[model samples]
Target chain A: MKHQFGDRRRLLQLSIAAIGFASASLALFIFMVTGTALIVVWVGVPVVVETVVKVRWLAELHRRRVGELLGEPIESPYLRRTEGNLLDQVRGLLRDPATWRDTVWLIANGTLGLALACVAVCEAVLDLLFWWLPPGLAMRAYARLSRALLAPSEKSRLALRVEQLTESRAETVDTQAAELRRIERDLHDGAQARLVALGMNLALAEDELARNPGAAKALLSEAREASSNALAELRDLVRGIHPPVLADRGLVGAVQALSLVGPVPVEVHSDLIGRLPAPVESAAYFAVAEGLANAIKHSGAHHMSITLSLENDLLSMVVRDDGTGGADPSRGTGLRGIARRLSAFDGALEVSSPPGGPTELAMVLPCASSLPKTLPSYGTA
Target chain B: MRVVLAEDLALLRDGLIRLLEANDCEVVEAVDNGPSLLRALTTHRPDIAVVDVRLPPTFTDEGLRAAIEARAQVKGLPVLVLSQYVEQLYARELLADRSGGVGYLLKDRVFNVAQFIDAVRQVAAGGTAMDPEVVAQLLTRRSGDKPLASLTPREREVLEAMAEGRSNAAIATRMFVTEKAVSKHTNSIFSKLDLPPSEDDNRRVLAVLAYLNG
Candidate 1:
């Protein structure tokens, strides 16, 4: 009985989505005609191009909606022309089949779309007016028609998948290179510098030891200090590479331990039932740590809170800070690293820090494995 | 005078024993692993224990764990934990009970023979001797604090020195300032940081640390 009602509700949603597209397409058609007519003045250049982009965006939404109604995935088929001159872009849009399909969709939506919506609404009213009237058959027919027009072919779906894989692969390579540079810079500035000083001090101490034992003691102490500091730097470097604490305490405890080191107070609330895959746990840990570090360093924030929970296959974490807001991905800082860090896991992050207030960052990772991993006999201490 | 030492590395362990003996402190027992350290602690009931952060039988925080466990068994048992890299989290864990007789210092501090001996003796006498790095970590927690902003740069340096459990004379000598001048700055810091007038330096340091941790 619930499934039947759910189907009915889905049918209603499908009809409403179609109606929304139909109205939007009518306005879009009006704008396109004006945009083309005013092309001689070049005032419509932006307008026409923007409409073209808007249509593609609208088709993506439509495809996603139709796919949701079908309870499956629907991939966008447009080979996105993210680079080109303006003339080439316009030509490219005109040359694309998806653009012409959008035009056909607009025209069809303008005519049959309006008729179908009116009939669907009137049928509901008539059903209320009468006793035994069901609109399932008509709604199902409309869904089928929309699907036939919008769904991508098998070959195009494969193409879309390949494009996505290639882009992510390229990004992974770039991220790796950037990370190596960062590690190299850290070593040069930290342990390497300290070791050089330590080596020099040891050499000088050797010379002074035989003649001036008193001064030699001071020099030896300084050298010892340098070596220990170098060791400290290497320890920190190792921790950053992979925190042994994470292995001992798991994600929740590791995060708690980590936040204790933040300059500002951090409250972490995590509700996860079982362990995530080791790689996923590590990725999520660094992502949250980076968010906290940024808040402490740049945000000028007083207090921060991190909350993690699992919803279905996704583990979601939100880190919020009270600070001088304005966290932009385009600007410098480790904000961009969060994306690169999670991209490997098919995870995504969103930052919302408008100027002059609180910054809230949300990260979500799809986890297919929620079974708690068995503890290794020896996980550090 | 008596101490139990736990360190994994043979060379460092030997060096530390020589350093302690030279400083006139007796080594009651020395162990390289966590279990032996625990057994030694119980058997000797030494005046204090100096444990490394990472030890054998896991090599990750085993020494710290053993020290905490030993302290639990022996109330206010002075334990000065040495780590290659000191973390504020571990420092807080050591100080969490709000009981004295705890010192968490970076192993680098051992190079300064006089200061390291002073810290060991201080911890043995039931006074805390936090590493300068740990103190720096605490000071950073209150960065941009409105009250902290009122302090002069010199006064901030004085506070850093004080948080490392240094006496006014030691701070004065180190900063190249007179004792009277150091005292005046401490008075100002106490008022500006709004620390209640405390006579002893250890209580003052703890008060300042607690305030910073806030």
Candidate 2:
């Protein structure tokens, strides 16, 4: 009885969907024809592009509806619109085979599709009147037809992969540039200025040495103090760039060093025996650092724990804190920055923070085992 | 005192040679790379070897690896490792063998020539000289440990000074207290940390370091 009721509901839904599809198909057919006719005057380029976009929208609606009926989601096959002037966008749209398939689908749905939709509507009506007729067979067949046209092809899947790589590459370049700019600003405002002051102090001290010993000694001390400050600033800047510990000791050791200085105690656990690629280690280190920083600043927690492990070719790291939760990646640039940094290396970040308690941030990255690895013996007793 | 100095840059190497010579310590051999440093250490058997952390040909802890290997070859070889930065991990590794003659210091510490020479002399006399930064990290890392937690604030300061391989007199001078007061603080810290009482200062330092490394 439940199955029958479900089928009846599905049949009614299909009937309404078919009516909508029929009207939309007719409207799209008229637009395509008018736009094609005006193309000789060149005023219809945008019109044709706009019509193709509308057709894709119409096709997407049917795809979702039919996919729901079939219990399988249909993948979108359209190429992402490339960024450029109007001509490039138009050319890209026209170059895609899926656009042509969508055009053909629009035409076929206008005629044969109209007929199938009408059949569906009639079958739904007949089922209500005569309870012996099968409720949703016609709707199932229409869904299959739409699926055949709208489902993603192998070529489109490759195109989707290329789209993803291109986006991540661009983001990585931007992140590097921003990092370089930050280093430059730090040097300019910090060590560089201090060094200049140190030099000036030394020069004045040298001149005063012949005149008075006490003033010269004071100036020399001032110069020494400036130089020390400069060194400290530069050390910090270098650590920010690439921690020397990360180079000397691998990721786990570096994180152990990081945990030592934080306000709250952080317990670190790891089973990683060999070093990962430097970039992967660096990314994981910064991600954990950001996670710890966030927890310390906002979580109001007393203790945190970091766990790292390697299995197969994947590296997994988790930073868990026992604190009041509610960490939103969209709301915090720290989390988003970690995401962007990881995405560059085909890595992912997952945050699970419920409202009341322990927040866990897990990161996973594929570290190919074929790369040469240094077995860092952190035999620190 | 005789020394084998290994630093990559020519200017700093020359500066270090002059500094040591001015302090009445002879630099027996000065080399720029890891292999040469190891060779110098083995052949000269100098009183001490001052090595950089980064050196050619690999340039990534090559000097440190060479120093470790040299120590393995020549037991109790005093090595003073210097770098722009310091790590508690590296410090612990250097001290893992528990050989008394070892030191790890930041390159910046050379600016204070008297204290730097003092550290070198201390390490040469079969003692330890850890950078204050590394010692501070040791103190903080073990803050949660039970023994360290029970330390009074004054005792904790004395412990940090001791972990940096300072003698009681040096620590007392720095803390602006008498040597007697510093020794009292050290005794209190040893009792609190449950360390076996020893007359030798280096043993006290090594015990404090081992406890902190936990």
True contacts kept of each: 0.55, 0.42
Q: How many angstroms is residue A308 displaced in model 2 relative to the true structure, after the best TM-score fit?
A: 3.9
Please name the candidate that would achieve the greatest lDDT relative to the true structure: 2
DockQ of all models, two decimals each:
0.32, 0.30
Query: What TM-score goes with each of the models?
Result: 0.71, 0.84
Put down candidate 2 lDDT per residue, B2-93, tens digits, no spaces: 99999999999999999999998999999999999999999999999999998887667889989998999999899999999887767877
Mind giving the per-residue lDDT tens digits that candidate 1 earns over B1-214?
Answer: 9999999899999999999999898998889999899889988999989999888887778898888888888887889999877777777778776566788888878877899999888788777778887776666565555677788989888877766767778889999999999989988877886776655544554654664465
* Candidate with the greatest DockQ versus the true structure: 1
Candidate 2 lDDT over A154-216, as tens digits, reads: 777788788889999999999899999999999999999999999998999999999998999
What local lDDT score does residue A68 receive in model 1, on the 0 to 100 scale?
Answer: 70
- DockQ, prediction 2: 0.30
Model 1 segments more than 4 A misplaced: A1-142, A152-166, A184-197, A211-222, A243-250, A257-263, A272-277, A296-300, A311-313, A324-326, A330-333, A354-356, A367-381, B143-159, B175-209
- In model 1 chain A, where is the ten-residue run with the lowest total lDDT? A372-381
Q: Give Cα-based local distance difference scores for all models.
A: 0.78, 0.84
